[model samples]
Structures are given as C-alpha cells and as structure tokens.
Target: MPLNLSQYLHLRSVPSFRTILAVSVLLRVGLILYSEWHDAHSVVKYTDIDYRVFSDAARFVLHPTEGNVAQGPLGKRLGLGDPYTRATYRYTPLLALLLTPNEWLHPSFGKYLFAACDILAGVLMHTLLTSAILPHADAHSASPARDTDKHYARPSTPPSASPAASPTRREQLAMLLAATHLLNPLVFTISTRGSSESVLALFVLLTLHAAVRARWAAAAALLGLATHWKIYPFVYGVACLGVIGGERGVAQGWRGLVGQLVNWRTVWFAVVSAGTFVLLGAGMYAIWGYPFLYESYLYHVHRLDHRHNFSPYFYAIYLAYPTHYVPSSEPSVWQRVLASPLASFGPQMALALGAGVLFGRRRRDLVFAWFVQTFVFVIFNKVCTSQYFLWYTLFLPLLIPQLSMTPRRALQLAGVWVGTQALWLSEAYKLEFLGQPVFFGLWVRGLIYLAGHAWVLAGIMESYEP
Candidate 1:
C-alpha cells in the first residue's frame, strides 16, 4: 500500500540534503539519457536553442579556420557592434574556451559538464548556508532561552512540549538552501539546456563563499571571473566593500568606512581583481582579437532585445519607441544618446544611486545586503531573460536563514513569483513556439512580471532594513 498524505508529508519534510541532491541527479540523468537516445550531438541540430548556440560557438573556438560555419541568421541579432563573422558567438571568449569539449568531442559532454557545474553550485551553496550564514543568523536570532537549551534540557526540565520535536534551525535551512537550488526547475532547465549559466552560477556562489570566509583576494578574483562571464556581477563590487567594511566594524560612520577602505587588504583586493580582468581580457584579445571584446562586452553595454523579452522597460520601449524597438548595428551618435534609457542606462543609474543611499544607511549585515543588491540588479535589468532569474535564486536561499518572514508571507511571496513566471512563460510559449499572435499579451505579461518582482524586492528591503 502507498503512504497516506500525512506520512508523505512527514517523509518529504525530512531535512536531508542528500535526498535533494539524489533527486537532482536523477533528473539530470533523465535529460542526458534522452539526449543520448536521440543521437543529438551537433549544436545547430540540437533541441535547446542556447545549447545549440553555445556548441556552435565552441566549434568555432576549436577550429577558428573553419570556413563553413553559419554567420548566424539575420533579424535575430540581440547585441550591438559591427556585424559579427560568427554572429551567434555573442558571449565572452572564456565561455567559448570552456565549451571547447563540446566541439572537439560530443555535445553530450557539454551537457554533462554543465550538469556538474549545477551540482557544484548547489554544494557551494550548501556549504555557505550551513557553515557560515545559517550559524550567523541563528546566533543573531537566538534568545537566551534558545541558547541555554542545551544546559537546561535535563530530566528535571519536565520534557517541555515533548522536546519541541522538529528539525533544528540549521538543519532546516541547510535542506531548504540545498533543495532550492538543486530542485529548482529553472536551474534544471538552464543546466540541461546546455547554457553556461551554470558555470556563472557556480563562480558566483564560490565568490560569496570566499568573501564570507574573509578571503578577500579569492573573492575578488572570483568576482573578476564572474564579471567576465556575465557583466552583471560588477554591481557586487559595492556589496564587496560593504562586506569587508562590516567585517572590520567600520560602520561607525562614513569617515571610518572611507578610512578602512584605504587599508592594505582592500588595496590587495583591488589589485588582484583588476589584475585578473586584465590578464583574462588580454588573453581573449590575443586569441579572438578586438571583435571578441566588441561582440561580447561592448555589444551588451548597449543591447536592447525587444523580441520575446519580459523586461517592463523593453515592453515600454516597444509600445512607445517602436522605431527603436529593434536595435541597430550602426546607430548614430544622436540615436545612441536618445536610446540610452531603453538600453538600460537609465535604470542602471537609478540602481547605482539607490545603492549609494542604502550603503549610507550603514547596513551591517553585508551578506544580506549584498543579496538584496544582487536581487535588485536582476529585476531592474533592461534585457531581463528567463535565465536571469537564476541570479537571485542562487542567493535568495542563502539569505533566507537571515530573513524574518513568517510562514504565511513566505508562501505568498513564493506563490506570486512562481505564478507570475508561469503566466509569462505561457504567453511566451504561445508567441515563440505555438505560432500565436501574443504582442498584446506580451505587454500584459511584462506588467505582471514587473509587478511580481517589484513586490518581491519591496518585501526583501522591508525584511533587511537597516
């Protein structure tokens, strides 16, 4: 006989990272088996678009002299710059170099590599949460009675409430953080879809781990690598300073903070971070030339992909600035200035200003503040994509142990986030795959996404208030 509902719930609620990781592995194995049975080894002929693109680009990296590779299709250009020789290769050279095994061997190898990175990210998240953040949060939230429980729990204690049987706070948080990343549908999609987002996610979690452990140079180096992989982690610079400063108890005032920043450790972090960027960038330039920088980094600096994107800013640009709906490769200087806001400059500026104000408030919990910072960075981006959600998903679980949200509020937030994503993706599927006209519905979906994410950010700020 099958387990009843209560039994099922009891078993499911067990705080076991091993169980979560096992389920994650099973899901990944299914995806890999499916690919193998289909013999889908080539990039272009594969099912997942991003994976296909990554494989194709990796092929170019493996054999730069190959003359037969397609120069990407027209009208599908998302980033700016000169017409790319290999138009589909829009990511950093490091990513191409990383994906070379897919080109040299089989695409299945690439899928497995990404799966490994996905699992590695979960491991790093578990370590960060269980070893560091959870303990710190527990200490902060623990009361005298809670801390004294060990000493007071004798037979004379009268067995208060049957020992309050439940998983300890640390165990619950460890399972939650591990399972959130490992079992997240979005994480599975990106990993099996063959996107390098998993690699980026791994580096991000590692960077945070290093930072929390007071290994500033390691954190800075990892941050540099992450920034090269995806430009968004540049925002983490502010949060890094905050973390280091908070560690040194420099929150007395701005003057003390400024004085602390001039210390040797901060200088070392800066030197190491800049040195990493310079070395990696010089290597890429030598391998792929200026076009690598242009296509990969500069292109994204002014990118505006209105097609099938869910950014509210891009949606407004589509409806209001139809001429600027699709980006131009050779936009004039005047056009560039006029399109800055739609290109995400305006919102980025607003985010920078907001970060300044928040920092001024001297929020001492640097890790939690950094989580909020990264969350806002993703939500306010102009070119928000489906995979972009992974940015916060990686950090949110780490931050959860620190948050004070009630069970009801947490449920509401989770419901709103998942519901909005489902609704938006439903419309997106109709437009991209089902051959339906969803232009108007796209606007509605964008609004819903914006509102949902905005609500989440508001709640985070409220919970993490200084």
Candidate 2:
C-alpha cells in the first residue's frame, strides 16, 4: 500500500534529522580542531574556574608523592578557610580520576584528550538513541535464507531466530530518543565543554539501555560504573530493583519475587558496585589518607548548605521584602528561613525516601523517575548552577518524545531550554541587557524561566499514571 509505504518513508524523512546528526558530529570535531589550533598558536591559559581546579588536581595526580600543594593539601585546599571556596568549591573524585590520565600528557594536550572523550561520548549518545528508534532492515532480503528456498519453505526456526538481525522495536524508540537529545542546546553546549557530564550522560544511557533490554547483570555493572562516576545513578538502581520485583511478583509468585531480589545476578551486581566504591574510596584514602577522603568526598556533600538562592525562589523573597532586602556576605535571611526545616538531615532523608516510594515501582517508567529525581534535586539543592542542567539533559530526550502535547507546546518547551542557555551564556560572556543585571540579579526573569521549566515538569508528572 502506498499509504503504508508513505508511513515507512516518513519515518526516515523527518526534516532536520540528518542536519541534526551532521551538525552535532561536525561541531564536536570543529571544537577539538579549534582547541588544538589555539593551543598550537600560544600557551594555553586556564581561564575558567573549573579549568583551574582541574589543572591543579591534574598536577596533584601526576606527583602525588611530591606532597607539593599547588593549591593546598586536600582538606585545606577546599574552602574551609576561604569564603569563595565555600560558595563555589565542590569536588567529585571521579573527575580527578578522569583528569589524572590527561595530566600525563601536556595539560593542553590533556584537554584535547578530554575533548576527544566528549566527542566519543556524543557519538555514543547518538548511536544509543539511533539504535532505539530506527526500524530494522528486512532480514530476508539481506540474508542467506533468501538464496536458500529450503530454509525458507518450512520456516526452519522461530521468528525470533535468524541469521540476520534487524533492529528491534526498542531500537527505533532509541533513535527518536537520540533525536531529541541531539536537538537539546544544553546537551550540545555541555558536550562541547571540557566537562565530565558527557561521559556521565553516556554511562546513564548505557545503564538504562541495559536495564530496558533485560540484561540484568550488565545493567547492574553499568549502573555501578555510573555510580562510581557520579553517584546519582544509584537512584536508578533502586528504581530498577523495584520494577524487577514488581514484574516478578506478577509473573511468578511471592517466592519468585523474593528469589529475584536475591538472585545471583543481583548479588553479583551489588558486589561489583560495592567493590568499585570501596576500591575507589581506598585509592582516595591512600592518596590523601582517610581525613582527606572524608573532607573531599563526604564533607563535600554539605557544600550545598551554603547556597542562598538562585532566581526561582529569590524573586519571590525579593518581592516580599523589596525595601528590607539586602544581599549579605553570609547566608541570606530568607535562605535561613526556608532552610531551617528542610535542611535538617532527617527531613532530607525523608524527602528522598518519599520520592523513592512514589516512583520506585516502574523501571521502564523513565519519565517519572527522571522528573522525580530532577525536581527533588533542583528544588532542594543549595546551589543551582547552570551546568547542573547537564544532570537531566540525557533523560530529557527520552522523556520529550513521550509528551502528548501539541507541537506548539513542544516548541514552547524548546524555547524554555533556549532561554535557559541564553541566560547562562549572557552571564558567561558578561553581556548586559541594556545595563540589566545578569541572571543572578534578574530575579524576575529567573522566576518566569523557572515557571516555564515547572510547567514542562508538571506535564511530565501528570503523565505518570502510577
């Protein structure tokens, strides 16, 4: 049927599909080439705040025994004595692991390596999504079975088995997922920079992909790797176990459910993940001793307590006290006011537990899990840096295509993403809007943008049906 043919053709004919793929690939290549060119032209300078920290960390990793403190020993190196450090400094040991190898090469060359990893990460993201969405090739036409009438005559095997394997239905879904991510400006910007987010995103994707494919052990191992890299992916593991347990209960029995939870595969995954954490922690301890590990990793968790407000809440508080409002060197009065109850340890744990109870049942419920995790993290976080957008960027693509909204709704959401980047980029470039203050100062603009983000998130939440 021509209509059927049209449907098939349209799948591949989507506008901007090829362009999106090409541009994403080309931009990454260009960035690397440009960075290399710039480095060759002059001595590379650490201009960005993260760059300085990374450079110093790289030096430490290179000569750990030297005991030479470029910044300071681990505990003192953190903002214990420095106010700016308290406000801005946060450390993830995984970042140091990534940077250490790059430090072996010249720092500039090492940047190139990091950039290359980002490019590879981008490509992997692209492939992962493509594998999700594209339709499978016609196996018969491409296989030896076509030439052998005997093999085809009686159907020698089940439909599931064949010499040629076409892409599965899930793979087509992945392709669409990839398309959304490719178009995401935040993903584009983050991938271009020398951040661990691209890799972090890749690992998340891999873990999810493995989980969805029912590769339980592989999923666990990927999740373990992801946890070692960032720590948030552990939440995904909780979601996965919930789903597996639920599915097993329905399909098998209570005994089966219990057995599935304590299955060899699950045990192996737990061991692998735990072993990884212990090994990494041990390595950190060896390098800087237990105190340094505690300060850098454990104490770093409390760093968020210092953040007063970004745009979202700041605007509301500002309007309430327009005359009395004065930004202080210490935490804002409003921050303390809102902080007292929520910032308490018991409440934070309860909040996390509540979110887990809410969305833990569906492993395949990507949208719910993403929304819950992102919302909780963003709303409660002490600091909401623009780069934090990277945390949810990978999940956004998969969630976006599932929305039932009109194209206009989609466009509006897209605009919000664009606006977010515009605000951040303006700050980054020190561009003033007719003497208007930056994002940190434009409290009203931040509130409006926050509302837009909330609207999209609400759509996601409403779509989740238990």
Candidate 3:
C-alpha cells in the first residue's frame, strides 16, 4: 500500500530526512546561482571544460554528419571520431545520445541533471544504510565499545536504539552520511562542472540499494548498465553476489563463498550483465560503427597517457617512451606489460577480492567492503584522477558510524592526505602551467602521494570496527 505524505511526515526519521533533503536542495540551488555570478565575473567559471566537450558530443549526436543539401547525410561524417581525432571526447556514445537535447537547451540543463543525480545518490546511500541497520537496531546492547586503534572509548549503540531527547541512532547516522555526500565540496564542484560520473554513481548506488533489499536480478541489471557506461563498477559485482548468498545463510566459511559463486544466480548475473552490456554496445555500434568501438572500449584497454598523469609509474613510462613514436598494428612489449593485470592491476584485484571475501560475510558488511575495494582500486589505478576519489567516497561515509576513530585522529589523517596532494600539485602546476621541466620532480611527488594515501587507508582500516 502507498503511504500518504502526512503519514510519511509522521514517521520517526521523516523530520531528519526532510531536514537533510531541504538543506541539500538549498545548498545546490545556492551553488547554481553562485555559479552564474562567478561565471559573469571570473575567468575560471564554475562549469568545467568537460561541459564544452559534452556540448560538442551532443552536437555530433544531434547531427551525426554535417548535412549537405545536395549530398544528403552521407558527406564528410561529423560523428564522434576516433580518440586520436576527437581527443576531447573519449566516452560512450550513449552519453552523447542522452545529452542530445543540450545542443538546443541551455548548458545548465546538463549541470542540473548531473547535480540531481548526485543528490539522488545521497538519498539512496541513506536509504540503503538506514534499511540495513534498522532490523538489527534492537538486537545489540548499548554498552560502549573500546576503540582498538587507540585506547579511546566510544559509545557503540544498538542500531537505532531509542533514547530520550534525541532521534533514533540509525536515522542520525543515515542523515549524517547523506549530508556528508550532499554537501561535500569536492562532489559539489564536480557536479557543478557537469561531470557525468555522478550519473554513473547514482546507478551504482541503485545497484547496491537493490542488492541490499535481496533483489539480485535488479542489482545485476543496474550494475551492468553502470559497467557498460564505465569499467570500474565491475569490481562491486562480487559484493552483490555476497549479499545474495550471505542473506540466505548459505554454507559456512570457504564452502559458502564457493557455493555463492557456483550457483544458478551467479550464472544468471553473468549472462544478464553481458547481455545488457553487449546489447547496448551493439545498438551504439549499429549507429556509430567502429570509431565508437575503438574510442569507447578499446582505447581504455591500451590507454598510456604519460602526460598529466597521477600515477607514480608516469616517469618510468615517460622515460621508456620511444624517442620517435609511431602507431602500430600490434602492442609493443612494454605496452603489453603495462596493460597486463599481473603488472599493474593484479594487486588491486587481489585486494578487492580479499576484502570482499573477508568483510562481505553478510548484507551489513556490503558497504564497508565496498569502501575498501574501491580504496584499493583508486590507490592502485594506473591513471588515478580526482574524479576517481568519488568512487570510494560514495561508500566511505557509510562506514563512519562503524569506524572508531576520534575526530582529531581523522582530521590528522585527512591533513596528511591533503599535504601529500598539495606536494604533488605544486610540482604538477609548475610543469603544466609554468612550463617547467619538472617531470622527474613530479614523479617523486606522485610516489609520495601514493605512499600517503596508503598510510591513510591503513589508518582507516585500523579504525574500522568490523
């Protein structure tokens, strides 16, 4: 039965939810207005350069070829070219199709769309965590738990244990996390710049929300849609399977893990995911042809951008680069080495799988395991970017209630992370803008940034309660 608005308003958590929603909405609205004013006054506008790239893609999608009166639509094609030709746009054609209206509509339309998705993601995150913790709210005692990382004591309340003069504990945690994502300046800045990663994030959040509710098929389809759009979401597929198996109380230990993987559902998940991705790609292929294929899928597989890269290996790759480079039919041995999972991606996969197996023992474990998996993924990615941080941060806040770190300790670690980034950015700035030859210096900074993140992640791991 559908509940009425009044009934919803009277629910225990509604007021807090409303507060979160209202504050977030107001903040976004204010940012939009501020963006307009800033664009009017400042050279560096709020909207990012990607907005222009998206607009160009929309233009191409709207008119795939520059139409001629005499030649019809088959003259020189204006569709998205290969990455080498249309270097500005290197993503799926579906994004261009989705944003086709932006060609005619205002540019802010895209920003509004991405921002809406970003806010929606926060709502889903809250919903997933709130639902997850509610059932077990009454199952635990309210005794304070000892923080193991340091010798500090923290109140470990039963999930939403009712208390005098306060809201339910779970609701507060959920609202806090929701607010964290909604008001985060990093996410806000990206969404304002009209990045589509938030759209991808919304679908991934939906996938998790569906899986937590024991809806396996929906989870697989949603995740598949997300993976087709971007490759990183595939890492969370194991968490979805774990949710299904752990919820149903399968066999114990490694046997349960194996049983989880060897089931009909797992097979169906694979089939559906592949079917969805292939169907989407096939549809786009039928329209855009191989340029779409190469730019969207193949390019990322062999991507080796040695410039403006954040990985520590950038210097090594730069030094190893051929003095006089030429495109070839076959991948060079060095290219193969970089592309190989054993060399670059093996550690990330292994860590993600280990985190899934160890921490993904139940539905409650999904969010934390997801955070860890993504943490490892970004840290180990060959082309880590600021946008990639959004992936892990999507789930990181969900673990705050479960984490036993003190405010001061968390801030200390955050400062360490920021200092490392500042160190790298200083060198990178000189090279990129000032045109200084600081490639080796930037490489040293990248290594420092990598180590700093690893240290911060270790601190986070130690602070996690489960």
- Any idea what lDDT model 1 has? 0.65
Off by over 4 Å in 2: 1-25, 36-47, 64-66, 69-94, 101-106, 109-185, 250-272, 304-353, 416-448, 463-466
The TM-score between candidate 3 and the true structure equals 0.83
Model 2, 1-466: lDDT tens per residue?
0001111323454544456567757776576556556655867532334655665665554453323322334434432221122223345444654666555665544445444555455455556445442222223222332223331122333335532233443344444555556656555545444555666766777777776666777777777777766655666665666566555443256566556556655566677766766676565554445443544456645433322243344444434343444555455676555444344344434554456544655455643575566555564444566777667665655554333344454566668766764664455354243554453555545555567666766655553323
Q: What C-alpha lDDT, on a 0 to 100 scale, does residue 131 get in candidate 2? A: 48
CA displacement after TM-score superposition, residue 9 of candidate 2 (Å) = 7.6
In candidate 3, residue 53 scores what lDDT?
Answer: 85
Candidate number of the best TM-score: 3
Of the two candidates 1 and 3, the one with more favorable TM-score, higher being better, is 3
TM-score of each: 0.79, 0.65, 0.83
- How high is the lDDT of residue 416 in model 2? 77
Question: How do these models rank on lDDT, best leading?
Answer: 3, 1, 2
Against the true structure, candidate 1 reaches a TM-score of 0.79
Candidate 2 — number of clashing residue pairs?
14
lDDT of 1 by residue, 215-244 (tens): 888889998888878777767766666556
> What value does the lDDT take at residue 161 in candidate 3?
48
